[model samples]
Target chain A: MTVLVTGVGVVLPGGGRLADLGRTEAGSLEPVDPRSRINRRGLRYKDRATQLAFCAAEEALNDAGLYAPAAEAPVRAEIGIVVSSNFGNLDTVCRVTGTIGAEGTLAASPMDLPNASSNVIASSLAIRFGLAGANLMLCSGATSGLDALSWGRRLITAGRCRQVLVLGTEPDNETVREFTDTPRMLDGAVGVVLEDAGTAAARGAVPRLTLGTACRGGTLADCVAVLAAHGAPARWYPPEAVTADVLDGLFPGATRVDLAQVWGASSGALGVLQCAAAIGWFDGGGAGPVYAVTGGGRDSAAGHVFTAPPGVAR
Target chain B: MSAVIAGAGAVSSVGRSVDDIFTSLCGGRSGVGDLRVFDRTRYRAEHAYEMDDRPPGGPDVPLRTTRWLLAAIEQAARSGGLGDDLEGVPVLVGTGLRELRSVELRHRGAADIGPADLHFGPAVRERFGATEIHTLANACAASLSALALGADLLDAGEADAVVVAGTDMITESMFGLVERVSAVPPDRVRPFDRDRLGAVMGEGACAVVLRRSADARPALGVLRGVGINCDAYHVTAPSPAGMAAAMRQAYQRADRSPTETDLVMLHGTGTMLNDEAEATALTEVFGDRAGRPLMTAIKSMTGHTSGASGLLGLIVALRSLHTGAVPPTLGLENPVPEAAPLRIVTELVEGPSLSTAQINAFGFGGINAVAIVERAR
Candidate 1:
């Protein structure tokens, strides 16, 4: 069973859609207030990271034509969600932690306690969207976003769910900045709607691209070796740590595109953002077999191969 | 093919080794005591289940969660006979707070926090030489989710052996949060008791080395399947329907009927709503057979270990399957009305010849995960 990326949504700096992913450089892009993009009813108590997730999720659902009126929402339990974020809700967690440290633990509001949990963003998204499928939250360093996609694919192929919303988001806040040291900070969310190809066809939804071989390993060489099993990639989206000389040695003929340089440090959003960029490349008449690899400056890395779907003009 | 538990390790407040913990549980000993991890005078309740074997430097140490995790992993590897080197094998960690306690300790002028300590990936890499790592924070159901992912990796031929583990340290913030939220100050965790107040916080780490059944190694038990789902209901509150659905899903994936289940490890948190809801879920899933499955809530003695609770309960259930001696749910003098439809183990049962067991783990955000395990034939 093949998995298809049917929808793409991102809350990047400036104003760039799925088509302008690689071309437009997000230069010190300021975060946008999610209240303007999403419903304001449930926006009061949610943290900024969750609110950003909501914005990106709304756009992705709308793009997939899966967004329905509240009263018209069909059985939502058939859909699942996988979220990847390392520092998305650290601001809230730190604030609550600090409040309990300064004042008594009773000082922290009951409303804010839920946000202290690492799974808050994923759970909040599920509650807001009424998705009851196998929900998961991944925070496995830089390759987290790719791990989320991998899990989403497993959930679909395992028949746990027909469609899974995979989200990768990060927020650059005071607390996150204190804990993290990155070349560039990102404050945005990227979402993709992954559906079983058969389910997509039955729903009359056009797929952006077909997911291909995916691999994760302890080192860049391991991932590269496994991802190269099918054939040499036409284009390679390399991690920030991989230089042109290394890429040349590895892929040789393939073009190297670094999205981290295009848009600041992606953190957990690296892999999903890379997939969104691949979707844009395919839409712009790019060729097939593009591999996006990310190693969050750690010993581990995750990579996925994206191929243009059959019948798509290359 | 089912994934076999090749080796297991655990370090909870009750005991350090799995055998010791099982013995403590069977002896009906309660680990709950005065909260010493933090200043307890500020809270209404001074009692908690704190680990006696804390690493050197007391409670204000950095990498507290990492230390516990590495200890458990070491024990798991040693017992599973996997040796010290785990070079190519993948390690999946399920943690609710991860190193939040460490981060909190850093605030009070503790050792400088390393970036690698924030997630278990770097530490696992450094210690075990594991290249591929996944850390999941699926609330309290985190470990079961990791176990499920491990099973999936085995099923897909991704790894011949995978280490699935969960660890969490009770932070002052979390301890205080529980204290402030409970309807009444919880003096003890009385799961399914009519007068149950709320859950007390506990800290520990547990790990299991999973290998394919075809490995021809000694097996603790066979992990049949794990079912995970979100209630999407409420953040702090659980949904009985969602809980039942997760259990039913596990049974279905395990290809076993509820009638075949001889033991059930309940996710009874001793909270007013959680216990009642769990009882309701049991009734819904088992129907008339709910009373047939012998059930026990280990939280009554271990307290709530957060993410580590799932694996801790699983270790108990596996031991039960092995020895036919089930642990008691201490302090269950009077059963709640909702529990009337089920068989609650008030004292240890030494004989049942248990073959199959189901472990339920429900977390905040309505994340529910249930794992099915069977004795090795």
Candidate 2:
């Protein structure tokens, strides 16, 4: 089955559209007050992670022109929701626990419990959009984004759903001070509309990119070998361009793209930014097939092969 | 392309071994007890099913849940005839929402993700050298979601063998959330009982090893089919349509009718809305053929283990298939009449052989999951 990336929504520390986000000199996108981008009414109870994800979902749905299922025929069953985040709302958990511990259980805000889990973003999106499809919350730490997308693709191929909105939502909380302080950890939310090629073309939506096979649980060597086995291209597109002396041998003379330079280190959302970068490369007059490896400096490794959409003008 | 559950293990308040847990269930056991770790004098719903014994494993095993996981995996490997060497098997684990106790401190320091997420799946990957690891945090129904994914991976030939595990520990935050939500019952867990107040929050871990039927030998049960859906109606409330649709999809995938199912291991959280919605879903799926499959609520005894609740339910179902006895839904003497045409097994029944069973797991985020289990042919 041919799965096409129909639309994308990205919010990084760097300010730019998905296509223009790659400029090295571009600073990270600044945080907009959650109230500024979205309505505050139902937004008061939600955490920043949930708020960011909602913004991205709305943007992607609008981009895909599939924001409203009730408006169209062939009734859109709830869209499958898959989100990847590692401790998306650690602060909420802490505050809820601390508040209850200090005060009484009744004193704690009831709203915190619902948004405390990582899946809160996805579920909130579901309720916001009235999506009733299969929902999943993947927390593979750094590799969460790719794993999330992988699961979304699995849902579509397994005939479980026709389209899935795969998303990565991470917030910069004081609880994650260490990760944020780290050299490459940029915090943000990114989303994409993954639909069947037939579905996209039916709506006259042009495909932005095509996600290929994704594999996990492998070492770097193991990841490289598996990608090689899958006939993945020797060319590489990493979050950072400069390669270490050792990893250079994995993909000889591979042209590298530095996505983190502009977007910063977004953790699991890095995979989303990488996908956007790949789409940008092709959409900006580059060729097909970009191999990006996530979780290089973290736990586990996943290799995703994405190709430019067919027949898109250079 | 079928997925066979080769081996399974669990660590609960009753026991660590799956066989022992099954035995205890058959003998009419209640794992619910007092919460020991924290001072619960000020809190409501002080009782819960908790593991008092320390996690049994090497001192090197890092966290509380990680130790339980390693022990369960070892047992699963041994029972499944897969041996200790799991060279290429993929591991997927489902844990609770996040760390409940140390969420504040763990974050104030280095950007360490919470201890729960870090210590579980990553530990499995590092200790066992697992190439692939997936950590699902879909709240209570997460384990079932992982099981569904593992089955799909096995069927797609993407994995030769897959291990699916779910673990959660009782935490003050979780307890607070349970209390705040008014989900904890006044006294004991009494599923399908008219006098039932709410559910008792429980804690534990369960693991199951799965392989393609062609490759697996001496399998415990075949995971015939799995269906999952979200209510999208509310984050905390169950949607009857979503629940029924998921069960219907499971039966459709397995090409079997729900009426023919021998037994059903319900999520039966013992909460008001969950039980009511579940009963409605049951009626929607098995309309005229009601009062057929015996309904058993294991949470009435085990308490709700959150994410691991589904796997725990599956454990009970497998035991029922093995022994000719079905465990009674403890604490359910006065059954609710509204869920009529559905027979609640309030008493232990033996010799009523069952070859097929179903497990229903509904999470807080309106996630509904159902898995069909069948006796290996």
Best-performing candidate as measured by DockQ: 1
Q: lDDT winner among the candidates?
A: 1
Instruction: Supply every candidate's count of residue pairs whose N, Cα or C atoms clash at under 3 angstroms.
Output: 1, 11
All candidates: TM-score: 0.96, 0.93
The Cα local distance difference test for each model comes to 0.85, 0.75
RMSD of candidate 2 to true structure, Å:
3.2
lDDT of 1 at B129: 80
lDDT of 2 by residue, B33-136 (tens): 77665556547767888776643432111256666777887788778776776668888887764444334434334224443345355677667767677888
lDDT of 2 by residue, A69-170 (tens): 322333245468788877577667767766776776888777777766657887887877767778888877667787888889888878787779888877
Q: Mark the regions of model 1 whose C-alpha exceeds 4 Å error after superposition.
A: A69-75, A228-230, A241-250, B52-59, B214-216
Error at B263, model 2, angstroms: 0.3
Per-residue lDDT over B222-245 for candidate 1, one digit per residue giving the tens place of the 0 to 100 score: 999999999888888999999998
